[model samples]
Target chain A: MRPVRISQIYLGLLLALLLYLLPWGGFGLLVRPDFILLVLLYWLIRSPHLCNIGTAWMMGMLVDLAEGGLFGQHAIAYIVAAFLAVVYQRRVTLFNRWQQAGYVFGLLLIAQTVLLILKLFSGGELPGLAYYLSSISGILLWQLVIYSKIKVTGDKELG
Target chain B: MAQPQQPTAFFVRGPSPFARLIFFFALSIVLMAVDARLHYLTEVRQGFATMLYPLEVVASSPIRLYRYVTGYFSGQTTLMRENGQLHLQLTRESVELQQLITTQNENAHLRSLLEVRQKLHYPTKLAEITHIGRDPFVHKVDVNIGSQQGVMAGQAVVDGAGVIGQVTRVYPFSSEITMITDKSLAIPIQVERNGLRAIAFGHGRDETLYVPYLPANVDIRAGDKLITSGIDGTYPENLAIANVKHIDRDPDSPFARIVCTPAAGTDRYRQVLIITAPPAVPQIETEPPATIRKPSRHAPRQD
Candidate 1:
């Protein structure tokens, strides 16, 4: 019911970045969710005026730098996903909680699919289906956050 | 009755979401092109990596603390057992070392008589692995030692067992070492049994090295030990690299499919030695007319 604060959004993004920077290895890395993207999507859907496509693009660039991959691969993926979320932002606010979760899942999958195509184009080998594990885990984390009373939409019930 | 307030139209958001997406998408494509093909963003990458160093350390601190705590609480009996094994190994090696010293003295005398070059001794620095690479597709590790410790890119990294990797990127206080299993890394190796030399390339999708371009009839077999050939000048001569694991000879193909398992603990070891001093560059002679003439004379006879 309260308006989102700019500082809170930034603090959340920073915490997500820290989580992304953790020294994850082996099986942990395989299942590690894209914390930054999940947080970005939360703010983008909840407070589009504060976090727009440009913000997602910048966050994706930071991830690309951290992962040491091609400079703009994650950036492009995030922009595309952010754009999709923005186009359907009003519709998302009207959906019920379950429907909203499904929509968020689609957005996460879209980001990953874009990244996979970019990686393949740049001579990277096709990874196993386990590559999509991050997306699944990301959606689970989103549901966990929503269940904990952290609103991600304008309507409290949907959030 | 309440009067309706006029809505403000002047304070509109700058652009449509689609417009913003297109702008960012074009920017990203340009950046990717410049980064992948032109490599114009190396400095930008390095700067960001340096800025992210503190966060990296903070993230890794938990693992470091766990290791320290476990080590401190390790049982005395386990320590004693390790000490006893090390003492026994030292005594066994001392006997061999004594023989080696005598042989070295004899070798020096023979080398002087033959007017040969002195053997080189490389100086090495020890480094601890900080983290495995974040990307699963790349086989790299971050080490604690970096440029501040005089660590440089392209230095050979070896564990006690054998060659593990080479330093590919150096930050101020950390460096990234690409392991022998990384797709981009290639090592010049010699088959220890028959001195057959070949270039081994890392497989992209797996933890294996491929020795391509070698003919199917090549004498290499499974279990053949591979050591650094030293022709590339990056790795020192005769360090254990890998052992042949599988050899598939296709009748239709000209090359044999040779796969090898790295001798060093590619996924196991935490400490490694980075050879700091590069091998001496051999002098190139400007004049070798006699050698050129002999090769030319033999060329026609072989034809």
Candidate 2:
């Protein structure tokens, strides 16, 4: 009925961060979705004014710290992804729900690719295909949230 | 820091996404260079990690609760069986301990006879594995104790069985250990049977350590036990490290590819002992010259 509030956007991001902090090891860690990025993307779509590329960058810094890798790895990735999400945001209105899912999947992939390049630059070995499993699970989670939103609002809009 | 705002009315209220991207991207690149090359961010990282400690505890609470519940509801028979097994093991190890004591004393006596330096026993602090699998590309685990408990980076970690890893990062409340099976860690080791020394390096995956640079004709064999050589001064002498599992001596290659399984149950063991880093070794006191020497270089010619 009303537009999403900025507080709600922050609350979602906080919850996603907590999820990211959870101790998911081994197989679970391999498939654990990038929860923070998903939440940031959702808010960037729903309320670009409240959650913009800057918000995305800050979240990325937090994720990078939590992950304990080289600083700015996740920040760079999120910047690229958030920039794409905002650039095509207008076109999002024309695309259908499935196409929207595909678009978000591509964004997640780009983010992961950027992170991978940074990782390789830092003398890290090439990871196996399973390294990209997180993006797959991340998009699945995005679709799940989208489906829930449609069910709750009874609307056909991408936003 | 006044950030740029959107100059024109648009769908969004902030600066154009492109401008924001360029700004953050440049900032991040600088951060990455500083963090990866200069390594000036450890204090910053530690401060943030300490702030995140409470959230980490909260996040890990579910697993802790699961463990607690299982421990509480454990069958009495299971406990009794475990207790029985431990007692048996204790008795078995006590016999070995008696033999080891005699050997240590004899070795000390012989060293004293030879005027060799006495070996020092290192003190250890027990820590619980708070979490495992930190860097995805690296084999790392975080323990409950940190600098507050005198756990410093470069300290060797071990279990009752054998070497576990080394503390690489120390925060206020927790420390990160880079396991010997990580690509970045290497342990100086010697074969138990032959005393042949080599360095074992982590292969980055499959939980295997490989001993490289050994000539193909070296006397190493499959199933040979490897122990810490102690030359590195970090790990004490004679601690179990691994058992050689495979050795490939190809004719084309001069060196053997020796892979070994770590002796410690790193995946299952939750409790580990962190051996404090050895203090700066005392400089050996040298006898001073009766008179101050001068122009030694010119006077060194013997007729």
Candidate 3:
């Protein structure tokens, strides 16, 4: 398998940020996936040496700035998720595609739950159940990427 | 195909993942505290927003192009129909405008004679909404105009219907409006019918405003219109704000639970007018009448 280039990872993260910056409105905004987090997670799981907790925290800070919410909410959430992913990186690579997807889904949920808690602490009201829809959509997107034969785990390592 | 085995790292990275996590987590908590408590990061936020302008433009281009195309392809019949309706409305309003001019002239003469403060004519600039706020929980919108266009923070934004919001943050080329339905916004309002004044707060989870702290037996009723009292000096005087929807008066509770539907299109409109003038400060009379010295029970409601 070809080694993943550091430039490619950075470019992918940038593209995800741009997608996040899109002018989503109405129902689209409610269900929009956390594109930057998903990309950061993918890199952390696939190429941990290249992208680590600091990278995730930086991206999370960017998200927080863009969101215009409580300043560090997304930063802490992303770092926590990144930590989980890094700690279980090897176990996740050994799993089958479905198991890996489930693990990623769990990480997404953890990120969201942390964010929700932070928001509540900041006096934000509880949003409806639709808040979790983004996690579901994110996992679905991950599945689509896997189906397209872009292995999240390094192919040579899997073999 | 032969693959190379993973090589052990010769040099250690700066810190372990957990240690780095702890450091970043603590840093984030400090940032959150500073931002929420002191609000010392306004310039930081504005600088980042300005840096993000190019990406925002790229992100919004698709919608802008779509709007341009659709506007270009609009049918001639629809245009003619709209034009005719506007013409008829203009003619009807012209009659009312003539009367308004005569009344304004008379009011000016009377105010001069009585040595009263002149009414301020606030200048307004029109702005187009660029995007709705990304966070669904916050009721805010980004408008195209900004400091470059003389848009300032705390200016009142309104549409043809009524007040929409106030400018909360201004960038170089854009500004953010925190809508009347946002959790942090509160507007001083007066009931149109009985002249009772109260403060209306936004319900965070919904698009309604709540008039809390009013006594259960307050004169406010369902369907009563609430207009800006202008006592707060943020919103203009007597502009429509909301219509009281539901008033829940529970026997156990001391305050009335009043829900109001906003008068403006809180989520629908694409254009609004920004009133740019700062609010006029009320003048204090030098000589006080003995009768007026004592506060009347209805004094607060007079404004």
Candidate 4:
């Protein structure tokens, strides 16, 4: 694999943003995974120097606006998740693919949990266990990408 | 293999992770407060959203293409069968509609003879669904028509079947319709059988509407239909809103929990009509009504 370029990262983020904008409703909307956060986390874990918590925070703000929800709800959740990813960035480099998936799963759950709590605080009804299913779906998507041989970080470092 | 650059690992050069976290957390908290409490960020959000419009269209293009392709390849026999069914149904409905039109004319003439006011003809505009709401959490969507198409806030959105929702926000080329399933929306309805007026709120958990605060003894039955009462002046009178699905009278709860599925698919239809009449905005007067000592219980519902 070659070195990851800034342009590639930009393209990935832009595609993720588009996916985030697609009209979703019905059961799909309820179970829709956080696409932008998933992409941000992939980049954050793969190249911490290229994408950071600040970047995640900004994207979260965009999600907030698009969702027409209380602003900073997703921003805070994403920033917290990004901070955790950054703290363990080097360790993530040491982990093999499954371990990385596990870590990513944890990060995704943390973000969703934080969001759920914030929503409850704002008088939203308890959305039940199904609300967390999206994280599972998101992690499954991540694993699919890994198995497809689309390396998040270039494989040169692994070699 | 080439060696990695020494300074490339300068991840620690910026503020420490903890400091950055604190800074971002504080900033997000402030932003959340401003957005939630201040009502100052609507225009800012709309501007940025308008900018993101192109990307949205691009993202939705594949789905549109898939729908078109599938529709094209659909079996010809099935199409012919559906066409035949529709033609038969149309012929049957046309006879009934003609009779109803004659009755309506006779009723209007009778009302005029009695010096009664004429019923207003409601105008509606067609709008196609651009996409379902991108956020699964929010019950809203972008319609193909917008402010340029004379779409305005508070206009009722309906489908061929019945009421779907209301246009809450209008952009240049598209407008946002908050589905009746959205928690923020409430529609005034009259029970079709008895004409008892009540408000229906969207049950956030599912695609259902709830009529709360009705006494357990309220005169409503299962399978009863709810129609727009036109008390609010936003929705016109007699549009089918929902059908009473379940009426739970549990001993534990004080109010009867009446749940009804919306007559219109809350978020399912591909096309809807935006009723063109703008909602009449209530004006503030010099004195509030209570001081005049008007009876509250028998307050008249007005047009």
Evaluated with DockQ, which candidate comes out highest? Answer: 3
* Residue A149 displacement (Å), model 3: 1.9
Best by lDDT: 3
Stretches off by above 4 angstroms in model 4 are: A145-159, B1-11, B281-303
Residue-by-residue lDDT tens digits, candidate 4, B83-176: 9999999999999999999999999999999998787788999999987775555577778888888998899999987899999987777889
DockQ of predictions, in order shown: 0.56, 0.53, 0.58, 0.56
**What are the TM values for chain B, all candidates?**
0.87, 0.88, 0.86, 0.87
Write model 3 residue lDDT over A41-61, tens digit each, in one string.
888887788889999999988
What is the clash count for each candidate, in the order shown?
0, 0, 0, 0
Name the fnat for model 4: 0.72
| Residue range A1-159, candidate 4, lDDT tens digits | 445676777788788888777766667876777888888887787777767888888898878766667888999999989999999987886677777889999999999989988887776777778888889889988876576666664465445
Tens digit per residue, CA lDDT, model 1, B204-245: 677889999999999999999999998887899999999999
Q: What would the per-residue lDDT of candidate 2 be over residues B94-161, giving only the tens digit for each residue?
A: 99999999999999999999999898778999999987764566788988999998988898999988
Pitting candidate 2 against candidate 3, the one with the higher DockQ is 3
Tens digits of per-residue lDDT for model 2, A1-159: 355667777888988988888877888888988888888887676556668899999998988877777899999999899999888876764576787788889999999999999988888889899989999999888778667742212265645
lDDT of 1 at B260: 96
What docking class should model 4 receive?
A: medium
Write candidate 1's Cα lDDT for A10-124 as tens digits.
8899899889888888888888998988999888877677789999999999988778778999999999999998888777866777888899999999999999999999978
Model 2 interface Cα RMSD in Å: 5.3
